[model samples]
Target: MGNNQPTEKSVSDTISDAFQPILETPILNIISEIFQPNLEIIPKYSEPPNYNKEVTNVYILKLTDDKYYVGKSNDPSQRYLDHATESGSAWTRKYKPLEIEKVIKNASHFDEDKCVKEYMSLYGIDNVRGGTYSSVRLTNAQKGLLTQEIRGAKDCCFRCGRDNHFADKCYAKTNVHGENLPPKKKIVQSRININELELLSSETSSD
Candidate 1:
């Protein structure tokens, strides 16, 4: 009886231990797989955001003669297109197909408005505005004429009264007679020396 009891007890205890190990092995594996300290599980969100701002600058375009169109813009290329396509203002509409001569950026920073105003005042009011007729269009001749007129009005020169001629040919000069007269004295120092030498030689030969 004691021997049978010992065998049954040992078998029952062995089976119970085996069942516990089977159940606990899977649970342990699941817990380890799910709750273990994983370094790669959390997603990283480390990317930079984007931002930008508008910018302001100056632009210039060349016109006929010495004239130009000065303007301001956030984008110079866009502003240039706007002027040509009549997109923004009446000025562009009136002056279609404006030829861009040059572009001057940051003109506001350089006091461009003051410079343009001064240029207009010196060149004449009409110089800033384009003429109505093709004949009146700003030309190289018209530019020269305007420059002459401006200089004449200022009484800048006595010769041409405009900047074309010099002071030597000045019609306003009072020394007209002096201008055509010959030089005061001839340079005869070399001639005098030669003559003295010849006379000394002739005297020595006679003696």
Candidate 2:
């Protein structure tokens, strides 16, 4: 009779076929692990730092009287408390319960002074004080004198002894009402006298 049992080669082929699926299972798992969405949780990204956070800032406060106060402070919150308690400037004291309208942070004194001047320009020079305000108006003669005096000046003001401003333009030299001292009549008289003397000298020289 022909052999009814499977041949050795056929048995080996059956074993190989059975092991193929088993070998493929581990490779399939590896591929799924590589391509599968990550199951491990990851930490969320953090928010960026706020560069505009107020530190040594310029702030504008709207007051109860409908006026505005422009101020500069390293800590605006503390300054606000001073203003609310009437320990601030006279202007802020008169107009109580100020609310901060805007803040400009991370600025130098020059920048703060610039902001204050801009606010003054928009609202009115009298809106705020104790910082830079409207520049004092100089008469032609006063400007001439100021120019002459400042030709060799290491500093600005002769009156307030400040560096960057002339005597006539110094706010500290102003009266309590913020008006400049009346232009010295003595200087005017001296100028007129000198002019007259020059005229007389010229007439004599012509003769």
Q: Evaluated with TM-score, which candidate comes out highest?
A: 2
103-184: candidate 1 lDDT, tens digit per residue: 5544444444544443544545344532121233467766556545545555554333435555454554332223343333
Residue 115 of model 2: what lDDT?
67
Candidate 1 deviant stretches above 4 angstroms: 1-56, 63-67, 118-124, 129-207
Q: Pick the candidate with the highest lDDT.
A: 2
For all predictions, the C-alpha RMSD in Å is 22.6, 18.2
lDDT of each: 0.53, 0.63
* TM-score of each model, in listed order: 0.31, 0.38
TM-score of 2: 0.38
Clash totals for all candidate models: 2, 3
Task: Write candidate 2's Cα lDDT for 84-161 as tens digits.
Answer: 998987777777755788877777556765665456444544454335442334357744453344332444455543
